[model samples]
Target: MVEEKSDRKKTNTIIFDASKKEPFNINEGYKILHRRLKNSWKVGANRDAIRQEILRTCDVFVLAGPRMKLQDSEIEALKEFVSGGGRLLVMLGDGGEKRFQTNVNTVLEEYGIMVNSDAVVRNVYHKYFHPKEAFINNGVLNRALLECAGKRVDSAQDKRNSQGLSLVYPYGATLNVSKSSVALLGTGTACFPLQRPICALNQRQNSGRIVVLGSCHMLSDLYIDKEENNKIQDIIFQLLTREDIKLNQIDAQDPDITDYTTVPDIGYLADRPFGCLEESEELPSDYMKLFELNLFKLDNVTLPAVLESYEELEIKHEPLGLIRPHFESPFPPLTPAVFPPQFRALKDPGLELFDLDEEFSSQMERLAQLTNKCTDEDLEYFILEAGEILGVFQNSSVKRQATAVLDHIFTQVCEFKKLNQD
Candidate 1:
């Protein structure tokens, strides 16, 4: 059911929009980022006809859409474009209330990728990634795929699915990667996985480079900063052009997606809050100092001791002005505030304390590590606390606190599941 676009010759600009659904601010979003009525159309991709227009004519198919059951022809067109060397950028979401999972990943599976229908990737509150209500995380783009994307907001909030993840704010989910030319930028002892933004980042045997993410709204003018959304924009540019990196256009859609029989439970990652860390220049130097303090009890100087100092660093500025100054706030009321010392206190008391800053910073780092590498013993204690905290968050106005509770739940639950099954 593909809609036949007016075969417009001006295909060079770009085609951006959602599946013509109610919630997606796709068109307006393009206006904000590109700052003009984009040659982009605000059509829907979830249906057959619209999918045809997008999958066929659009040079780079940019999407931040609700769940869509792909039509066969549209799927074929997508494969053909990629096989013939066209680029695509799709941003799947937790979806609107009409929420039914689509198998976009099944088609990509032939190319060594898979996007599950029910499983939605959620982000935890933190630095480096989520800054505003909408924010961009990170990715390893195939140089050939991301060459065109100059800059675009990478992640945003879901008015419907406000289920915040705890691993990477506005970003969450599991990613098991093999080896590829995919180059990820960022450093830390442990690496976080791409939950929603997972597809576009993977490479398929068909030779097309895919740059996936946990959420699509990550790219919004509401969230864009000169330095932050590069991962999304870079890949956007890469999908529009070729020869920058090695890629193949796929002709046939992955057959598995078409089956529509296998979708199961929705929640794929652990049930608890996924703890995370994100960095942005707009916020206070120690904006994340509290999370660090609340989790591990170490100071910044000591915890990030191995990392470079924020003082020596300079963040890239946006031509349009700092992206809505999210770390600050769009709604005057949402501005982030320093917490009362006790309110920000660590949930557990086992860790040793050092200097004020170092104590908190060290604790945050350790807690991050603990979440990443939780054990049977840790799970027992965390489970007890998670139940209590979940109740607290149930009546709370704060989301970060909710995220902290979930982080512990998932980590502990993971251990609990493994142990019980064993």
Candidate 2:
């Protein structure tokens, strides 16, 4: 007898990467987006190093704003994941390597996608924030998304209209992808006349789909709800739900990183070791020394030690704990002195630096000869030379004298041209 086959669909799973020092915190700011997907799919964080076995189970692998370079094994696992029909989404921000300091291009370039190092800016009307916060109104929606957008309002189709909707382009970089890749968004040429592409998608016939977004800020908590950023959430959901994309189950092990185990001691937006004010050179040296000492003390304290020390200090559970030092001192502090004493204002001595009567007489004689007997060509040459003279003198007093001479020469040239026209 033939056994009856079950017809249940497999449960989709998505994992947001946190092993690469990504700036956006999914648990905190991105909780809204996370909560939306958790209802239907198994959404979780990949805190440990990326493993091939993990990717095999995950239907969607999202690497957003990675601040460090991916290990060779990680990159291979991602590439293999997509090749095995798993959807992959890569989101990068502006300042490319200079900002995230990650070697993202090494992985993307192999897939015919290149992320530029420059920031995409909208010099025209932007959100109330900085100019880098570009606003994108023109986006070429995909066919599936177009159908969703064309649906009537309040209808079932309207719920997914976010697919073809335009999005707010925050501080993002531009992309260079292959011609086969579908361009989803093109930035205006107002700020950058090139009109570069910012978002693209490449769907293999039956393999995994690759989606690239230039800016990670669109998904960020602070700006995700602003403007049309909700479209990002919609698109991400669609990518995660697509059933055609397949992944394999594997009994693989995580990679061993004996040579790549060390991480740099640089600070990120999350684990800032020092306060913003402590970075300024104007701050007192003693205060900085004390601040450094406090940071050192705090670094060695474990979670339990921190809680125990808090009880010893009898500090409330307020935002700023009383155990932290104010870093202010009452002792006699060194007086602040001007940094560059050489650039101080120059004094006007009683004696004149140059004999104005003699200099003026010489300039007047030269001008008189050039304006009267000199041809129009000579006057034009003098005007050009006079502009060069003004450029050479940088001091205000010297520049003023040079300007007066330049103006005199320019006037003569203008008057000479007028006479010639007459």
Candidate 3:
């Protein structure tokens, strides 16, 4: 059953599994790709174990490089979620269990897809990084949908299309789709000079759909925007924004959790060891029972105070002549009151600053592109420049606003650092 959240309108909700020990998560490189999709749908992580109630709330479910096997109940929940017209995107890598130990094949077998245990390598047209960086030169997007996208199918448009477009498959496994499945992208005689299926889509029941990709890193933050990997983004866009799928809010409670709480205590131990096993002695069961009985008695009994007369204690306050020193803050001082017009006024400089605006726009565009693949040092350098730009502005309020934006980006860097630590 679907229900709307009181805070916002109901849209498609794509839940990425975090409970299954996935290598990729929102905290990592997938942050920006998800940020780009914020306008169309609600994308978030599922921290709790998968259950029927949780699946009912999600429009699309993703299991990417899961390192742990799903419980029996979770498997049933997933099966029911798909049978009830939900969409599932399963991503597996070439090394499979050897790398992540996530045996997703058990779930894929039920859907008529098999994840090969071997990695797909291309010695001929591989990326400079490694030979395993395979690229698909003849990927077929839903051919009919390509025409439906627009009238003029230019090179840029063709790259977005699923039909006859070469896409970067990267380090992934080759797939084995069933007879009813449609091959989205083929190996194209690149990996071992033998064609194989890399991505497959299957239609189950009336509205159910399942897309299996052999590569988990294809849509990751690092590779999603690389070479031909943008095609994967196009595929994701089509999947989440499709008009045929009906989206609903999940409102079911997790059955695994309960109200009752169990508190463990050292009192439950029969004996305590000091030096070695021979030196340790076991407590008498009767004495332990008596001790527990006393514990309960103390909960209900409050002993009287030793003093007969109750008196309030007073604390003496001593004023120490503490020296206060004036220290300069790192941030610039605010001068909004001195120049109120610059801070509060909204005036369009218009074409007067067109040349400057064009230059600023180009710089911003370049910064955005660099943000996707830039190193930590590059981000720090740009942030320093951004701070300098803010300092150049005469208006204190404008500088404050720009600082906020820079701070937000800095938080993203901090999150990246924390993820790396984990």
Candidate 4:
């Protein structure tokens, strides 16, 4: 029972190093990874400096996207821990050590694994939108990885069939794996750095192992469950913790990977151009003879021909003489104010032309004038003019006729008589 408990303690604990201010931790960016690892492993973080004592109880020590540089002592402690049969997993992002400002390569260089200071991108747009979110469909390098991920490995087909597993490698860099290390994953043909290594593993004879991944975000909460990534994570943890899974010897020695070739920055080169120098024309022995002195000279060579053509064209070629110009005016010429200023006669005032007597006359005077102006033949006309003068037509709504005016006046006279009677 004591041996059983010892074995459980040795194989169950996984420590995430946070001493270097790593971007992913147990409670932060790696929450999903932490929960997945919680079922079988005791996952925790070491906030203090990494030392031999802190890593003694850890079965797997993870350094996830360390943004700060690791001290020499801490690096030495990690090396010692791995050499003592403990497994180590180191993950970094694109732009590698220079962008992260970390010296993690100082330790990884000894194990024949170094993260490149470049990024992996997709040449074409596929499952993910961003170019940096490189979706590699055929990136598995070793057949053992297929077996660990429970994928069928066909030995009858070529080695390319081993790339059946797919994963999304987001914001990742590439890796340089030496002969001492085994490359496990590549960027595939679709990615920019075609078929280059992105993940590597190095195992010593002492049963100590180390795994380096290009991107730490592959197992973060945002992308942990994306396209067989969880299975890849399981394969990685299984390789580190369990001893039953073994890498294929032939694939480990010579991985299906291409050389890490760099592309020149065309934009940078285009900004600072160096054009080819054009050759000049060969000069004569006497440079003074080359100058055409008559090029700008005002010569009279064409003057004689021009004068001769004037006679043939029946035109005069004598010196031009000025002639009197006749200026016609669009309007008649203005005469002086000699005719003693004939001013326009004063305009009549806007006042109405009316007779004072007619305007000031009362209704009875107007009726008397109308009666005197009319005879028996003009009686109706006189009545209408009188009604207009007395304003009877304005007081009633009837037509301006002699009978209507008479009727209105008679109606008023009856109403006045009735009032008197009452």
Which candidate should be chosen as best, given lDDT against the real structure?
4
* Collision count for each candidate, in order: 89, 0, 4, 0
Taking the tens digit of each residue's C-alpha lDDT, what string does model 1 give over 1-422? 11222322334545554554523454465445554324343333333354555555555565455355666876776776556545556555443212535656555555544333333322444344433232223332222232233322223521211121112223222222223423222111123222222333444443444554434544565444434453445444554444345432220111101122344345764455577898865656766654655666656667464344443565343355665654755565556687766665557768875666534555456456446766776775554344453443563543434466667557768999999998
Prediction 3 TM-score vs. true: 0.51
Backbone clashes in model 2, listed as residue pairs: none
Taken over the whole model, the C-alpha lDDT of each candidate is 0.43, 0.66, 0.64, 0.88
Residue 396 in model 1: lDDT? 55
Each model's TM-score, in the order given?
Answer: 0.39, 0.51, 0.51, 0.66
Q: Write the per-residue lDDT of candidate 4 for residues 92-132, one digit (tens) a residue.
A: 99999999999999999998999999999999989899999
Ranking by lDDT: 4, 2, 3, 1
> Against the true structure, whose TM-score is highest?
4
Model 1: lDDT to the true structure:
0.43
RMSD of each: 35.6, 29.6, 30.6, 19.2
Local accuracy of candidate 3 as per-residue lDDT tens digits, 1-422: 22212221233788889998787887785786678766677788899999977777768888888888778888888877766777788887877666767667777777677877667777675554677777666454344323333333565764444344556777788776665555556666555424666776666435557888888888888788776576556665575347453211110111111122223447755466356556657777777553656545544233344222233334333465779999989999776767435566778666553455536666556556446656776756555556554343343543434466576557668999999999
- Residue pairs clashing, model 3: 57-250, 140-162, 141-162, 141-163
The 10 consecutive residues of candidate 1 with the worst lDDT sum are: 251-260
Off by over 4 Å in 3: 1-11, 141-163, 240-422
State model 2's lDDT.
0.66
